[model samples]
Target: MKRRSVLFSITFRSAVSSDGCKQSFIIRYTSAGRKKSEPSTPIHVTRKDSGELGDHLGNGHLGQSVHLPKRGSSNSNLGEDIDIPLNNPRTSSEPPRLKFTTTSRPLVTKILSSSDRHPSANCPNRVGAYTFGPGEDYLFSEDKVYIVKNDRIISSDSISKMFPSGPRHVNAAVYDQEREILVVIEEKSVYGYKRKGSDYKLESVYPKELPSSIAFTPNAAIRWHDKHQMLLSNGGMFALYDEYWNKSLMTGRSSSYFKNLPDRVRGISEWKNGKANIYTQSLVFIYDVARDNVAGEGVSVPDFLRC
Candidate 1:
């Protein structure tokens, strides 16, 4: 019995960069359940359209679509087509250096200031607002006093940057990754930015209370969970807000030594399988939102973790 089939579908995958060199390679497959690869080398095509190695296609080993360069091509310009390896076999025991290269388009960025000196136009001491961009791009924007900003976007392409504008400094800001919405807490109101194509639209604004001193650290206390829920704290009391930005989905107080000061939100998360956990003060509030009720009574936190 004999069967014929087209088994080749070639796709070029870029090599990762290290230091000043990139490792380009060609892949070979085998029936032994192993992948074989060799460094891609430039070839000066001969009249036969072959490389240093002979016509590597005699047995139809390479697919029919594989096209070799036509003759008269000089590989002297190989450096322009391939990245050279960084390590010199003769010396340099150090690790390979890194190089920056990306296959994607660039983002946008805005820099507000760069100084922390006395009475300068840049680098103010206070932070009024901060938020990340849509599409999970590594761009972040911040607002400050006098409406100054030093925005930045982390990206592989040097061009990936962002400049998201709105009201002045925000007390706190949270990004809803799933829905691509930005929720910002301000001195007197909460604002929501909905992602529409490359820009954000102010969809909702809930006027209520915002704490005067909600300094955003690496670990922000307020967060978005589920489809339309947010867990927030003043430094002591905790509450859940829905997407409307109009009313509290629910509110709860912390029974701890921190009751006198403003309540702070510690954490908020909901698993894909529907389990939810909200951490604040010394307790964890688990909720089953499908039922709109607490999953269980207040549970004690473990000592190993600091809420």
Candidate 2:
């Protein structure tokens, strides 16, 4: 059976500026059940002679005579279609579409190496616990807080500088881009560190209203901002805010396609009790892990549960 997909038709009209720079106006249309033109602002591009990357100057400007493709009428390979407006003030035609090619199998499977010595050679056992620094662009691991540059240990010369997780294990860690600080999360508390003259020292520790586990939340190294407190991906996206919660954020899900936050990464802690839970935007799944991979919808809300 053909899978269902909501297609978004985006159109960008390009023109060469007087200075030989490319300028474009973006127009978009979404077709699920009804076709509707999305209002967008005109966007300006950088001068070609500037030797810089292409970027929009300002917000998108609304365009005139928007055209939406007729259902099942697009010349492109995308199967879905929609009805266009009758009096759109312009001729109804399909907008320019980008062509996509599909291959039966992956072209390059080995990123670093295909030796199979590790999952992918040059990758550590605990990849989901990896963290990157701000500005310096250095990588660190959450297990022993090993700082690596080109896979070489560049952590502070002192052994004590490492933030090992065992007694008061680091539940989570993120780099604050704006402040150039490293924020660390523990079981019940949070800590922040900033680079001083030569070494990073304790900057602050927020002790009020720290996010707690909602059944499977502690499994999530990163927490969410919604009141639902929903997050259960092993490796997920994080937005480090001055205020702890109630901010815009994204996390991992079980879709096999491209995922915003990775939930299927390896090197995760093993599940206990032969039982596991899955969280989605709308539903939660409970699965028995010991025997067969049998999962049931609608997990029972426990009266008294531990994080």
Candidate 3:
């Protein structure tokens, strides 16, 4: 197997001071597995008045603040800068100690704040996830679904209205992007909804009262794999079901793999190829579906995903 190397670039910026002494440094590196190698030393650069920074060190001197590109601008290569404060004392002979941090693109650009619209204490088990349909984006929260455009909620509707009998408390929810379907599991039933315009139309509902080979508790971590058209749930045990809720695989309670899984599963997600990431509070297990065994386990959940 050919191992791929991932390239990473980090930018460090000093906090703006009253004296306007701000500095920005860029570091580029590549990593494969546990080995990491830096391609170049930190390049110090200052920004021009036009909000673009010159990469060459001769363009600007150190201790000068650089203007970052405007938010949502086309030329914005670097995202939000992690501000490193230089308030601590440093000897003149020693280089200024710098702290490095990470920043990601904002998940929600606009704040959806409303006293009555917020998550309620009465509905403590609210489930939400991002789903897209047609050319529009949407966010499903509990019984309500909101139309999101340009990372902002533009409109909202109650999906419960489409239900036969109002809204049932959702236990877990996962969206199948490939199939354009949203599956929501309630306490006593599993419901599938198809995207219809800005709203979701109820398509199928499987009652839990029916004898099921796979049992799902309230704490089960559910994920839908569109490639296989299968639903996976992991509570205290592991199980796999088809789109119609027919159980295809179920690990026995006494299985060695089931015995090793953590008591509380935080979540489950499809990983690279045919593997799945089973997340616990402290660790994540990479399970290969074909082999029906764990491929690997790691304590750093984010690092595993990066690989």
Candidate 4:
């Protein structure tokens, strides 16, 4: 069966300037009909201030339109379409807009080397990485924090400088953009850092050990939810916690439609409308936060990520 196209929108903020002003842009795209021969997908990127649009051809070039292959096209590297709901509201009078932009090179080129392995590594993990805006990604590894810009590591700093006596092995980290704070999770504690001018200041710490219901692990994944709580998952179990380290709920696969699946959760990817994609070793499924249940059947992991 032919799957319907899905619209995706991404917004990016530029680094703060000396004067405290910042620039931002939006990228919108759709996985629609496909052509047979063309291998690249076209993306539209729009500047928020000027409303100017730029076309990004998947080949790392701008201002060109590229055709995308059909679904399940063996010749194409683009994976299957995921039906993500567009969160931005639009009126009937305005036409739909699509935009796109990406780093010039892949972001994992340097971090995936065999010699650079760390104890915190987990399959399909994104624990210590957070993207604050376009071309800005912060990676927490061991006692160091690296800043990546335009797919390249620009600078790094000792974790101690950001959070005095911080954990040497960060299990999970996330940046709350709305609150302008960085949250770090270690073995049994959570720390929060408020963004200062060009640095971070330790603001709060939860010294209490985490409950057994959602204990920290190398394989754990966390994302800040819009409802002001952290959504965390490990193996097949999921839990929610507030800033005070209070656990409000605990759930597992046995309570959802995916109960028959294995109890191995590789990672969690947040999406719009209080929904998230839970990735296992071989399959990916949707989880709805509002319903606290699996929303759909599982799909095979994309071929690109299998590598």
Candidate 5:
């Protein structure tokens, strides 16, 4: 079955500085249906040197007329058409012309080396809980609490730092609003510093006898729980910790240890009905934390959840 997409033009008016007139307008069009409950799309207007309606810029101008090919009544391949009216100003013609700007699929290729890439990058495991920054610039990795900016770690050191020690863990960092601090969670301990003028002053260290698996709860809260909470797993479980790293609110693991199963914690989330979701390699299990028992069958996340 063939689906048809219709394109329509929408224009916005702004006063051109040269003419000092509000009547002059720039128009934009798109066929995409109802963008976020708003019909308007951005218009790109390149002013011609002459500043006239009919001025023939080298390639094409806003008001130039285009001629359509005589084949199918409706066309999809833009190559078949000639100069259609750029802004769809009416012209005497038999076959109606379509005014479309030339477009091409942008080509992108991976440039990072295998050693430089993380296992989680561009993978289905992207199902990890995330906290989006003010813009789409960075996501806070609860595992580490560091800033993952542009899918790369933000460093206090230079790129050469990667040669000796590799990239700093952005996953172990979190921004604290209450204290205005950036907390860094290392493998076996937690450390934080206050922002004093332009430098970071050392804060207290929380040594972990057993590091609880940490996950960011909804409403931007942090939750930790682990074997101390009687949840047993091979690798570790996800949990939330207080500022002092005292205890965990929840944990993801079987109440009794499984000898055959190497239960490594993957991700943690809370869904509707007071349910918390915990992910292992190939399974997603629902836990009723209040009751402290596994509640639902595991569902597999698809292989294409990568970003």
Candidate 6:
């Protein structure tokens, strides 16, 4: 099993000033389950010209103000002299400090704001959304926000988690309407439950698939249809399965390409025309299963797609 590497970036702009800096990184994985991370260039603090100093001055607490340079002395030449403000004790350091101002690419913004934010105490290393289950009757236990409604925990626990205390976030959930079952996918394993009296009963376990995300058809009562089926994409590939499970559809376009996609694929949504949409840091890829084509941009989409 060959490991792969992907690109990731983080932009930190001084809310104060404008020195203009950005940082990027690379993540590599090994077949032995070991991982290596490449650090990004450091970004210095900066102050924007638009009265940022005044804003910080007004607030007794100037958050992240270390990025700003002080005002220059009246006797110094504008270009030759450093702007070292004498009044502020905080800016007393005489050493030259490089500063930077950055804008988070819309894509990175989306990734950081992922919808999954809960971590089960037992599974602290998971990331994303998950369905947890079969707890004592009438007791619902989700990573966050749990409630029991109609004696069913599926709906209440099916929501996504954006932040988890552990290493990963729970990212996948499947609710069965026919049996009122809930399937959950965490970082390393999958669990399933079926309705039993007022509580759920443990059923079967799906084989572990490393670093994958999952989803089910929108309606529990109606399984995948010729119209549109629920799809799952780890951002590396996609799988489509029906109720019977007799036929499994798998597509991985440009195996080498998607295989090396970002480690953090934020969202996977099924689109009409047999295409699935995959989102990562500042990028949205449209994967056409029917035609085996892929197209997308590393930019923020307009409101239409968001709605």
Candidate 2 lDDT over 1-307, as tens digits, reads 5444444534343233567655443333243445444443434465543322222421133344544456557556353322232222223234457999986787765343233222211322332232345423222233444444332333422223543221234444455545665555555355666766555676544433344322222233322212122223444433223424423243333343222322432111113375433322222244454434436444221110100
What lDDT would each prediction earn against the true structure? 0.39, 0.37, 0.46, 0.48, 0.37, 0.36
Tens digit of per-residue lDDT, candidate 1, span 1-307: 4432212223222222333232344544344434555655523212321121222312233233444233344534322333332222223335568999898978867332433222332322222222334434221124432211222111211111222445454455566666666666544455667767765567644334544332222123244333444444443454455445344545555444222222233444434355445444445466564655456665543221111
Error of 6 at 126 (Å): 14
lDDT of 3 by residue, 139-167 (tens): 44557755544333455566566444434
Judging by lDDT against the true structure, name the best candidate: 4
- Candidates sorted by TM-score, best first: 4, 3, 2, 1, 5, 6
Better of 4 and 5 by TM-score: 4
| Model 1 poorest 10 in a row by lDDT | 152-161
List, residue by residue over 1-307, the lDDT tens digit for candidate 4: 6555533222122222344443222222334554223212323233332322222211132233434444545543233332222233232434667888985976564344543333332222232433232235555555676554433345667667756656665655655555665666676676777766776667755444566666544344445344444434454445555555445475444335233333455444545687666555456567776776677787654221221
| TM per candidate | 0.31, 0.32, 0.35, 0.39, 0.28, 0.27
Give the C-alpha miss distance for residue 94 in model 5, angstroms: 59
Measured on C-alpha atoms, candidate 3 has an lDDT of 0.46
Q: List where candidate 4 sits over 4 angstroms from the true fold.
A: 1-135, 150-152, 204-206, 212-218, 224-234, 254-307
Off by over 4 Å in 1: 1-134, 137-165, 176-180, 204-221, 224-228, 254-307
Backbone-clash count (model 4): 5
Model 6 TM-score (2 dp): 0.27
| Candidate 6 lDDT by residue in tens digits, 173-286 | 445444455544454344455665655455554333432223332111112214222334544344443333423454333244333333334444424566554444334466
Which one wins on TM-score?
Answer: 4
Which runs of model 5 end up more than 4 angstroms from their true locations?
Answer: 1-121, 124-167, 170-184, 191-262, 288-296, 301-307
Off by over 4 Å in 6: 1-168, 173-182, 193-267, 281-283, 296-307
| Candidate 5: Cα lDDT at 147 | 29
lDDT of 4: 0.48
Candidate 4: residue 175 Cα off by (Å): 2.7
RMSD (CA, angstroms), candidate 3: 30.8
